[model samples]
Target: MFDIEYLILIFRDEFNYFMMKKVVKLLPLQHRNKDCVAIQFDFNDSIKAAVMKVGAKWSKTHTCFYILNETKLKQRLFLSLKKLNCFVDYSAMPKVDQVKKSVNKEASLPKSHAHALQVFEDYLIGQRKSPSTVHTYRNFLNLFLNYYAKRDLASIDLRSIEIFLEQVMAKRGYSVSSHRQCISALKHFSELNLGMKYDPANLYMPRKDKKLPVVLSSTEIVLILRSTKNLKHRAILGLLYSSGLRIGELLKLKLGDVDLERNTIYVKQSKGRKDRNCSLGQRIRPMLLNYAQTYQPKVFLFEGEEEGKPYNATSIRQFLKRSCQAAGIQKHVTPHTLRHSYATHLLENGVDVRYIQELLGHSRPETTMIYTHVTERKIDEITNPLDSAIQKFNRMDNETPNPLLSRNENK
Candidate 1:
């Protein structure tokens, strides 16, 4: 959550002082483990004339001073007082400033659990993790932090983290891979932001179930592209499939990023905020150039109706859904599917894993290697043991007399 104490620093007068009479002190302390206010002040007689006049009026209402209105006064008043320069001599008035300072210090100190999230985001932007990976990390952090608000990050034991993971998996119905991702994000955040080392030795990442990456056949991909005839829709899908661009990267593209002559498109601030150049297929270059001429987009490549701005990520997804429905493709295909198909096709065409890594803007070659496993080369070579056994049985049957013929002769 965004910090609230800063608001208090901006609005101090109406809350801490009554006319000329200043509240001598205010302290935040716990009563029955609940937040409660402790206040102190001087009477009118002890102050100067101006201060006295205001003090008399304030002194008349003793009950008002102590009983903070939970609805109207309690929290906002404290916030407001912080704003009005009332903390000028906070240290001189140790009774009030000391307590407030402690609170401020606590607020400034980054929460260990929360710091982990920021660190992971930094890595994502720097390392250029895939959009899906970044999104999953963000969702996991938000859910985890929202679950444990105002709790001391250092005090949270391993058991707490495990329990939270279990709740997400068992009660929240998260897959094992998702659970592991949540753990990975949190662990990175803690180590980078809070200086809390999460040793992989003691902590076991949940075994991720190995699943094959789904790839559409070349014919099916062509069919989907053909189904979407509109220039904008076609361009979006074309860029995704042809360049292996993520939907977010495609949506964030600026017009200048596309170099028509060189047949390269620059991806800026991608998954890890890393910029890279992706090849624009010569085939789509004319189509894109034509669309550019028709649209005349100002900044973003894919202009929307609102004065040529790029289409939002959500809108792009909506367009893809509409296009899929129009194409009558039975499989549930998204823009990312186009990217997956692109990578698989590259592998099938004998593009080296190292080269694919650079084209896909993957930080590690291992990540790009997953596409190799999804290619047709592996699937085509897969021979079933049962097929060999069946062939042998057929050969034996042909060499020997048929069982039916032998039985008929005996009869």
Candidate 2:
């Protein structure tokens, strides 16, 4: 009997330890008046560290870590934790589809408003606007319609538009770019649907902010690339910086677009719907060759898990964030920041701005000229006036004796 009891105790302890290692609970909770998903697990230092790495915040009141209850974030959290062999139990939370339904119900427009938006979308399509542009314009028009749901679309005048813009700016805190897009969408919609003439004077367009692009130093770029352990991820970062490809352009790249022998990447239908050839770095060539052999992508250069499908932009961003963290870079880095760094570095290397403009597929030289402001080339070449003055003063002081010191010695 003593032997049997001892065996039972050992079994129970092992089971508890296994459960602690395997199970992670996710429950819906209201955190700071916002719906959040709380991550609850038994005390495990490794698990806690992993959750924190995934950007979950420890809530003191709730006594658990929580993240904003977003679908993408929830999926990311599940995948990230699952990689650690943890079984994420989110059974306590509502299904994603159910949540989306509730949100759609709350924001659904009336039939008349919906019809008007459909017409505006059709008009945008007829005008040959890009799918993304059409989607943005339609969404903005939908917002405008909902704001004036009871009023007729024909009744909206300049004052009404101005009022709506003011309310949106105050409530949603739209950025300068978003505000400008909103104005453009409204102007186009009114001209096409409401038979209003395009008059810039009547509509208020916010001035574009002249904020300089964030640039990573060459050393930081090297560190980011080196810190990325995955070959595919490193290749993505390499292509972005070496070839100066936009995230969208990079995604659209086919296998044939890359010329290893010529050391050029053909960017097709880039910004402004223009195709251009960009220089490829000799250093990245061998990595690409290795990645190609390993991945064996058929259609796109960098295919996702599913064959022929492009790798996700969000995945690139997520892994890039991890790489930056691993590299100990604190700057707010994004995929676009790599592009900016590419342009600035090239300018620093004495590349012509016009050539950069062509490579970047910028329709105007002025757009590419922005990098000139951020490049340190000219600034590094010019010495500071203060330094010059200090050097001159030091030379004079060393060359001549102090009169005050001589007088004091005589006294």
Candidate 3:
């Protein structure tokens, strides 16, 4: 197979060896006082049986599973984690998997707003806000607090907050998105945290213009794949294009979510906390298998250098940018561009728009209908009226041989 043709192979594998395999979502956190390892895992019979086999118990306090973290059960616990691909690689003696033993603790907050930030974080967790939201909202709040470090929380009102937003917009020259995010954070802090109402004017932000997503051609996508040399990077590009995954969804992928045997990827806990199955490209199957065997990613299909964490969305963006440059695709493409292209190309291939909606995990058909406007397939099918008229006139002249024109030509 030539370079780009490598992406066109079809694979058939009926047996699901990964069916029983479990993904350890959050690798067990060792709670010394609790004397248990708090493990977050996808629910499966095999996993439950493993927990029972270890005499492990569930902890409501931590909202996770607890295996007795004693020397007696340590080996058994590590073995149980094998299904998650998180066991220590005994081949490397000097180090072990941090997921099995280490905790990913957040950095300490500044002293000025530590207590208030803690309250906000606790509130977000209690409300079951997604991790990304918690991080973003917390950062925004931190900036707000940092702007007026000495201002008393109770004394500060909407007027003071509006000034801070003005500064953010004017001095920082940030977009409306940031300005709106700041307003949202302040609102959350005031209403939810401080139990105070903010003025409506302080919270108001102008609506942003809706921009259509960029879609790449299939040939351009192939060129990008051909340009990417690393196996993992290629697999990432292939999966992004083939599955039409959002960057967040791609990052959240667990080893268990990929079922090569079924040629499907289960997208769990997406935008609306909904799980959906997406098609796995048969051509990319071999690439995935190779990455799985070589990288041995634990907890996620693709992981960061950090032991337990999934691949960072920002880094993947950088990879795409570089791949685009190398492929000489001038269009400003992001990860979502591939997704838009996927939907558009599927539409071109005569796939029903409604089915495309499900594939993209859009709840509303209207949201999916936007592709119809941009799809060149429909536009390409349309013939120009002038061209048709010219063709008809030419045919008539050729067949009937207009006498005046024929006489002039003979003269």
CA lDDT of every candidate: 0.66, 0.84, 0.74
RMSD of 3: 19.4
lDDT for each residue of candidate 2 in 46-163, tens digit (9 for 90 to 100): 7887887666877777899998888778888888888888878889988877677644532577677777677888989999888889988776777778788888666667788888
Name model 3 segments beyond 4 Å from true.
Answer: 1-116, 193-197, 200-202, 293-299, 303-309, 312-315, 381-411
RMSD (Å) per prediction: 20.2, 6.1, 19.4
**Model 1 TM-score, all chains together:** 0.59
- Please list all clashing residue pairs in model 3, or write none if there are none: none
Q: Taking the tens digit of each residue's C-alpha lDDT, what string does model 3 give over 113-209?
A: 6678778878878879888778877877776776666666766677777787788654665567767766666666664545333665556675875
What does candidate 2 score on TM? 0.79
1 versus 2: better lDDT goes to: 2
Candidate 2 vs candidate 3: the TM-score winner is 2
- Angstrom error of the Cα, residue 57, model 2: value is 11
lDDT of 2 at 41: 89
Clashing pairs in 2: none
